[model samples]
Target: MSNPADPFVEELRAITGAAHVLTDDASTARYVGDWRRNYPGAARAVVRPASTEEVSRVVALCATWGVPVVPQGGNTGLVGGSTPDASSREVVLSLDRMTRVRRVDPLDNSMTLEAGCTVLAAQEAAAAAGRLFPLSLASEGSATVGGVVSTNAGGEQVLRYGNTRDLTLGIEVVLADGRVLDASGALRKDNTGYDLKQLFIGGEGTLGIVTAATFKLHARPDKVVTGWVAVRDPQAAVELLARLGDAVGERVTAFELIGREALAQVLAHGTPGMRDPLAGEHAWAVLFDVSETSALLDPTPAVEDALAGAMEQGLVLDAVLAASGQQAHALWALREHVPEAQRLDGPSIKHDISVAVSRIPEFIAEAGAALEGLLPGIRVVCFGHVGDGNLHYNQSRPPGMSDAAFRAREEAVHDVVHAITARMQGSISAEHGIGRLKQEAFLQYKQPVALELMARIKHALDPENTFNPGRVLPLPVATPRPSSL
Candidate 1:
């Protein structure tokens, strides 16, 4: 229990019932650490607010007391965005108790949900309404709407249905000053002024806390044909995408590139029933899906012919067509399980980078060579949504190098990957936001004017820098010279 004499704790307890304010180490442990165990944090208490009103009150109280706030959702973020700092002074404002489907307008093809609602819950709600909410991720079971919107997450279906930002029509945010910025209407076209919601969408809880969101829904695909193929390289995967685009372009829902090391990890250490999609140990592979909304349409034949064409063009080495829905799920499991497999294998330096779809091959080849030159015998794990140019590239320590030595080279690894990314006109971050993990790189890579404007916006919205401090943006650097003043 928090000290009753501390008026701040008592105030927090009052804003959110005592049961919701977790002060003990046991209760606050999960909220203070990220999933990767890479960025651990500390907080005095974890405050769980149940509604926008409660959130506003808590934020107001914190602002009045000049206390910094860290907004958290499902706590599934990879970049420590939601984790509280080690200061132990910041208040963790969690939305776990705010899971509510406020409204579902099936006629408008929209759904309004509270921020704490899990991505899977949102999908099930849409399915219940005979619609499809397409934003998805491996962490969907645990990731929340607020986190997804705040990070503007992109997932497997981005190739067809777009990301959370594209699906989100409106949002409700609790500003740092405790004002409710309610734009949660299901407006498809409201061109009156600047889209204020976009700022909060990818803000990573810096500008404000997303309390609720309104997301667009699509026609639920009745049938989905998924398959896996062994491709010669990333270029082959790109060409295969072109071929599929030429044939079943409308139905090409997902195209993921999986590296050999990624697949080997999955097959060797992943789920019990996991196995390679093809017989041989190919250098690279792909997992793709074609979905059709109409009940009468089956895209299997078209997909088969396209795969055949890709094979004839030497784009695909071998193919494995999922015979049933069960097989399709198994294949996707192979892709989804890579992250966990890698985690189980050992520590690694990770990169979430993107390049133009056309330049993926070059990026992969150059980045691989550069990393090899930096650290010979390094194990590279590269895989991602090739259709959209996002790649989850990771590097494990060399055979005999100690984990400490490899860990010491993390900044160099990031530099190499990001340098190649910049050379290829690519983004340093694709789906992952610039949380504490990428703040330095963000400062180094982001254009100066853009960074200045972002700083201005941050100042305008959160002048005190009370919201998720030391995230997304770094504080201005001062020269070491003696103060002339």
Candidate 2:
């Protein structure tokens, strides 16, 4: 006579306060959709839990009721990993209220933080403690530490600091059966059996809900230098990157590349007060950042020396080393504001892909040419972490095209670009995980053996698939028979 889903909601409400359990459509709107506004969905209810115990209780209850649970943080994930399904049968577990800097040991160079803390907030906390938290991103202002850890996000600084995985020393997770896995041990070297924390680092909430993490921090650099260099081509940019790496070595923190069209779009529609670094138009641009110890050398002179050498060798056509902090911020703004500028231009198809660092130039040239051939008049805006070989290869409609029309062709264009990526032994989803957007595509690229292994892990962990169903791994498809001679 009564709905089966009702009791589950009631139980969840009882566990994590009635005020924290949201069932109404209005309150769940933010948790029901993806960042790109691609996969809007509905959930039975949304649960905001402030502690690991509450999260464990909700997950256990949902597991018992055969109801799926989606763990969310900040809701800034580009993929649909955090969004609930449209079935309205799942419960969304939000970690926004658990924000706190639990501990900061400057002597140990580590900080313990709750899952709800924003990336920027963690950085600030570390800075206040006279340490550095270097997991920087464009969405740092809104992206939470838990979500960053869940996705294992890599940003501009990954060249030197590495991704979220490298920064994380340990994690605390709430398992499906109301069990808590206390994997957080702040030691720098732990060779304990099977590193369990890594299992949930990039699990996309399929394994367990990440409640807290202990991140390794670094000493704040005494000197910082940022440079913007113009290159004649992608090859030249790659060469300049190599030269800079040789010159600065490990101090080279960030190395990013921007195509001509991407920069043009940014200048045309981006936020005001950011000046273009180059005097004349160039085909591509590279932003390289350097940080060093005062005991050894000053980073400004090192960066300047690298640029001068690059220019002499013809790897860099033109360059500008930031004269002041204001200029440095302005130069970085051009790179940071690219995504917003792309959105303002029109509907754009995006691919966060990675290849071998040595093959980036070739990948860009070949992939761009292939996509352009498939979709005529499409403007290729290829840019991102060249040092890490991750490119945000996006395609925008040519001037005067309707947004609706361009958007309509998104799938076909994505296929073309992704196909080339596959052929080149590159990834379809790089920084962004395979949420709903690329779940099916992941099947096309991933080996059959690997898929089976992933499924086994998922089943072993959350036997009922009660954590974020219909995500990461695609629904199985029937394999066709091979034609025999």
Candidate 3:
């Protein structure tokens, strides 16, 4: 392993400061792995750049040495893309030190922020300007704006505001050759040339390192109405979404579907004060919210009426409308902690997938049946943004099942779920980028022409693969050389 005294380390220290270049094993350990701790990588050092210029210099230095640069943000990525590989042949480039909100134009409803800014910080900046940065996620507290933009994060508000891609107006990235692309001005419409900024948006730091971004903001909603509605099944949840959209139109901000198993996990393992909002044990539930521009206009009545109509049509089994802001917050807490509760439960396989909004029910039903037949008694903890057709269809070990045994079948479990997803014209990865986790599935499901185009773009931008190698793109299979011995 390279030490602090290595010339390479000295070169990196020259680019950034000595304090910014982490070389000690204890200090660099956290940067070598992912948040989930599922993917463990080894890096000689973790370089933290304080600005775009420093990031450019760091990338340029790495390129000069042919060292792969894995650009990481808040390190909250689930797909293991942010972490380096086990080879210890790479340098982890962290942008955590470059969290500068360069500008915020409330009049333009836009904010230009460095990649290191936490999602929450960006949201607060928008709020301070009397605007809204709607791209939200459970990891917003830790997930950085650059990471979200790279993954093209889609949260509850995606039903209304769309993904990070839609919210991003421009970006400033450091190409593999250490060239700076300063396209960080918010432009509502620019048709003169190719949309170059977008290439690095969801590029997952493969083509280049995203140093900063300019995001489009929105007017802050004056009022929000939240509801917890019990539905018969996924189909009912889909129908209810349609009904709610018809009544409230674009006022529908979020529509999340929670399975009974998912809810039970939360109620069982969640913190105190978290309780079931609705009465009776239903198979499925939906957590939805409607927002209005004027505080005087109460969206509660409209939501209640929609639920009532849905009940009459058998779309809604029962419902609880949040009467106060506290109640609404409590309801959202339940939905957000589903994954945490599952983690407390045990080891399991997780799949972040998406199909058409209309085909979600069918996909869920088919995928569930397929998985059960493959591994009977497997507890399915399925839930997600139903309005956007994305579902975190995760699985847990059955009661008293050996953890070792359950984990041994992860590949088989994923195969069944992914096969069904492919058959239904669904994506193996929805909001989450095809990081190391789903690279194989991505290759399997993505069209040949599409894959070719992606490879072409990667080669065109980073021909030497100086940036995140063996990530979104599948690693080439190794063929044994003719027996030389």
Candidate 4:
């Protein structure tokens, strides 16, 4: 399988054109590495397929030569799921050229889109059709639909709308054997059998390449009320969330918990015009939003009532509710700008972990204490979708520390955080898939029975391990480490 022979490369070029087949270092540089730049590798070549047929042909050729194929989408994934390995034995299959909005049926409340369509584009299409495609994320502008589906992404609005899994109705996938599975349909209820599409939803492109998807849509909210509330602690934030959930029911769309450190970073290094919503400094803040259908009652009244109750109960110290759409956007900007702010600060260790909703406060308290004890003065930026009980717990090195010093302690920091997460029966990887970054940890944390089952599924669907071979699941005992190692 040495470079799949020049004839095979010529065939791939014939199928996707010479311009699309990238063999040079510069053209393939972006595709060789993961988003965090922590995992960099070289591929035999990069192939950009503009159609499902082209994808199938490329996959077939790779399968014939026993060459591993890595399916890549937007490449914005936090995990290294889309990055190729150092072996150069695999070909990077990119779906960037397949972007297209095939159809939008407002009456059916569904839309069909190619895998390469960015999440932001899908949202805009839904908006044009007077609906809401609620799967949103900080990287929506760059994350593709296929990548979102593969990772089963959960974002700010997951409280009301759910994750990518819930939003997706059906999918079209190209299996490892080069067979196209057309599972796309508009059926609301299909209890025919196993619901095979689910296997590929969060499979991390290990089982197959998601070519396109049909997503369910919701009625556009006519009135949206966004608010920023400062809380004393994580417990207070959890209590406030329960009260709001009870008060507004399904109207509460987004509930985010922002630690004081996270907020401080944003206010210090974030975009202009961003201001602290509360007067006095607090240890934590909750950014909650509520929305409702146009024909239904205005959601602002309920949001206001919930905040009033929270304030009286001492759960919320101070709060500010958005008066208009512009104000609402401004409120969200604070939450959205956190990652950018953290990036500007320095290289940091991040954990996307989740625990039971009721156990979130405990997990945070214990994990934060443990991490602090291990490394003094480590700036912790903890925030995420509280409704989903997922937190983006990240650590910034203490001031004046060299990058080399911080890099040296990466493993120790991760061990402390992940141990706490495991003890609480929580997940180490929440929204981000178990790519190269967390693959070893995933094996260490997952139960033996669960791991065996995952391996069985992988073997059954991809016997040769031709599709995204090194992602999501751990390698089998017989499989050797990538040669470049």
Judge candidate 4 at residue 356 and give its lDDT: 93
25-80 per-residue lDDT for model 4 (tens digits): 99999999876787898998899999999999999989998889888989998888
RMSD, every candidate, angstroms: 3.1, 3.3, 3.9, 3.8
Error of 4 at 77 (Å): 0.5
**Residues 222-294, model 2: lDDT tens digits:** 7778888998788988888787778778988999999989999999998776668879888899987888856
The ten-residue window of minimal lDDT in model 1 covers 476-485
List runs of model 2 lying over 4 Å from the truth.
Answer: 1-5, 476-485
Go through the candidates in order and give each one's C-alpha lDDT: 0.91, 0.87, 0.89, 0.89
lDDT of 3 by residue, 239-321 (tens): 88998998889999999999999999999999998899977888999998899988678777778888888899888889888
Candidate 1 segments exceeding 4 Å error: 1-4, 476-485
Query: How should the candidates be ordered by TM-score, best one leading?
Result: 1, 3, 4, 2
Worst 10 residues of 4 by lDDT: 476-485
State which candidate has the highest lDDT: 1
State the TM-score for model 2: 0.95
In model 1, how large is the Cα lDDT of residue 247?
85
lDDT of 1: 0.91
Error of 3 at 409 (Å): 1.4
lDDT for 229 (candidate 1): 90
